[model samples]
Target: MIVRAVVEGRAVDADARFALEARYGHFTAMQVRDRRTRGLAHHLDRLAAANLEVFGAALDRAAVLGSIRAVLGDDLRDAGVRVYVVEHDGRPRVVATAAPPTEVSARPQRVTAVAYQRYLPHIKKAAGFAQAHIRRAAGPLGFDEALLTTGDGLISEGAITNVGCLSGGRLLWPDAPMLHGTAMRLLEDLDVPQERRPLRVADLPGFDLVFLCNSHGVVAVGEVDGVPLRQDAETLARLLAFYDALPWDPLD
Candidate 1:
C-alpha cells in the first residue's frame, strides 16, 4: 500500500495530478531499506539521462532527491520508492511515491515467450501499456511472467525484468534492445564470466539455468515457452549473494 505521495516536495495537488495523468514521462523504482538504497547513483543517472531524452532539459537531481526524502520522512525507513519526471504546465516536474518494501520471490517463476517489443526499449516509460497488458494476460495463460521477443524469435527482456541464462557455468545476457535495469548493472560489476550474446526462444534448452533481475529482486525461471529450465538452487543463491553484497547508498 502507498504510505505517502509527493510532487515537487509537496503533497499531491491539482498540478501534480495533471502531471501524472500526462503519461508522457519516465521513472525509476527501487527498494529502500533503512533509509538507503542500492545503486542509488545509477538510479539518479538513469533519471538524468532519460529526462534529457524525454524533456530536452537537464533534471534537477537535488530536487528529485528532496521529493523522495520528503515522502519517506523519518517515520518510514524501509519502503518501495519511485521517482518520476513528468511534464506539467509545459515544464518537467518530479513526483515521488512510497510504499511497503518488496523482496525477491522465494519460489521459482514460470514465463512464456511473446512476440512483442516496446517502442524505446532503453528508457523505462512511466506508463507502458504494452508491458502492462502482457503482464495481465500472462496470469490467465498460467505463467508468472511474459518474456518479450522480436518477431524473429530474438529474446529481448521480460515484461518487468531482465533475463540472464546460465550456460556452462557462465551467465549470458541477450544482446537485443532492452532496459538496462539498476540490478542488472550491479550484477555486471561482479567478478563473474558473463557476456552478451544473441539469444532466442529456441535456444532455451541449451542453458543450464535461467534467472531474472530487476530493481525489486532476483528470481529463477523454471520454464520458458513450455521448455523446463534448470532450477539450480546453489547458482541462484550465489547470484543473490553477490547482489546483496553491494553496499546500499544512504538517501541523504
Candidate 2:
C-alpha cells in the first residue's frame, strides 16, 4: 500500500533506495490526514534529537518537513508517513515514504515478553533486525508482538510500541531506556493520572488495564506472557478519544 517515496525533496532513485535499505539511520512516523498530523512538533524534534545523537550533526528540521511535503504533495491528503535521516555520501540525507493510512485496531493484542533490549533504545533507528527477528520468532507462538524486557525481567517496551499500565486509576509508563513515542508524549500532555516508574514483567497481572501506544494509535493489551489482562474498554476508549481529539498540525 505504499503510495510514493521521496528522498531529499525528490523522487527516490535506485541509489537512494539502496542507501535507505542498507544504511543505519533514524526515523519518525505519523498518520497524516488531510495534510495534517498530530504531534508534528514532537516528530520534528525527535528527528532533530535523533539526528544529533545518531550522526553527531544537527538536523535541518525545515528540510525534513520539505521532504515530507514533497511526498505528500497536494493530492495525497491521508496516508501513513515516515521521515528518515541517514548518512549518504558523507552527509545526513532525509527520506520520506508514504503509505495508506492505518487505523488503530479495536481488537486487543496479546504479546509475550522477551529478554531483549534495543541498542540505543531512545532513538528510533533503522537497524531493527534484532527486534524483527524476535517478533518473527514469536509470531508462530500465538503472540501478536514481542514485549522487550531487560535481562532481569523489567519491561522496557514493545517491539514497536510503548507500554503503559493502568493501576489504582493511574497510568504508569515504564521509566526504562526506551523510545518515548510521540503518541505517548501527547497522551502525557492530556489531563490524565499518569506517572513514570519501573515496571516488571512479574507485575503484569496486578494492573487494572494494560495498553500499547505508537504513532498510529493506542490499543489495549489482552495478554502478556500468557497472563490474561483485563481489557478495560472504558479506559481504552477514553484514552483513544483524548488522543484523537488532539489538534492536527498542518503539514505545510
Candidate 3:
C-alpha cells in the first residue's frame, strides 16, 4: 500500500493524478533501510539523465534525497521507496512514496517466455503496458514472471528484472538491447568472470544456474520454459554475497 506522498516538501494523500496526468517520465526505486542503499550515485545518475530527457531539467540528487528522507522519518528505517519526477501542469514535480518492502524469495522462481520487447529499452519510464499485460497473463498460467524475448526468439530480459545465466561460475548476460539495471552494473565492475552474449531459449540448458537481478536483489530461477535449472543453495548464496559486497551509500 502507498503511504503518504511528498510534493514540494509537504505531505499529502497519494493522488492518482501523478499516474493519470503525467505518464511520460522516468523514475527509480530502491529499498531504504538504515537510510542507505546500493549504488545510490548510480540511481541518481539515472535520474539525472532520464529526468533531463523526460522533464527537460536535471534533478538535484541531494534535493531528491531530502524529499525521500522527509516522507520517511528518522524512525522508519525499512521500506520500499520510489522517487518519481514528471511534468504536471507544464512543470516537473518530484513525488516520493513508501510501501511495504518486497522480499526476495529464497525458493527459486519460474517464468515462461513472452515474445515482446520493451520500447525504448533504456529509459525506466513509467509506461509499461505491454510488460504488465504479459506479467498478468503469466500468473494465471502458473508462472511467477514473464521472460521477454525478441521477435526472432532471442532472450532479451525479464519483465521486471535483468536475466543472467551462470556456467562454470561465470555470468552470461544477454547482448540484446535492454535496460542496464543498477545491480548488474555493480557486478560488472567486480572480479567475477562475465560476458555479454545473445541467448536463445534453446541455450538455457547450457547453463548450470539462472538468476534474476534487480533492485530487490539476486533471486534464483528454478524453471524457464519448463526447463529446470539449478536451484542449489551455494549458487544463490554466492550471488547474494556478490551483490551485498557493493558498499551502501548513505541517502541522508
**lDDT, model 2:** 0.86
lDDT of 2 by residue, 8-39 (tens): 98887656655684578899999999999999
Model 1 poorest ten-residue lDDT run: 13-22
Give the poorly placed runs of model 2, Cα more than 4 Å off.
none
Task: Show model 3 residue runs off by greater than 4 Å.
Answer: 16-22
Which pairs clash (backbone N, Cα, C closer than 3 Å) in model 1? Answer: none
Q: Summarize candidate 1's per-residue lDDT along 7-91 as a digit string, tens digits.
A: 8988875555545834779999999999999999999999999999999999899998999899898799999999888877778
Error of 3 at 172 (Å): 1.2
- Candidate 2 similarity to native, TM-score: 0.95
Per-candidate TM-scores read 0.95, 0.95, 0.93
Tell me which of candidates 1 and 3 scores higher on lDDT. 1
Can you rank all candidates by lDDT, best first?
Answer: 1, 2, 3
CA-lDDT, candidates in order? 0.87, 0.86, 0.80
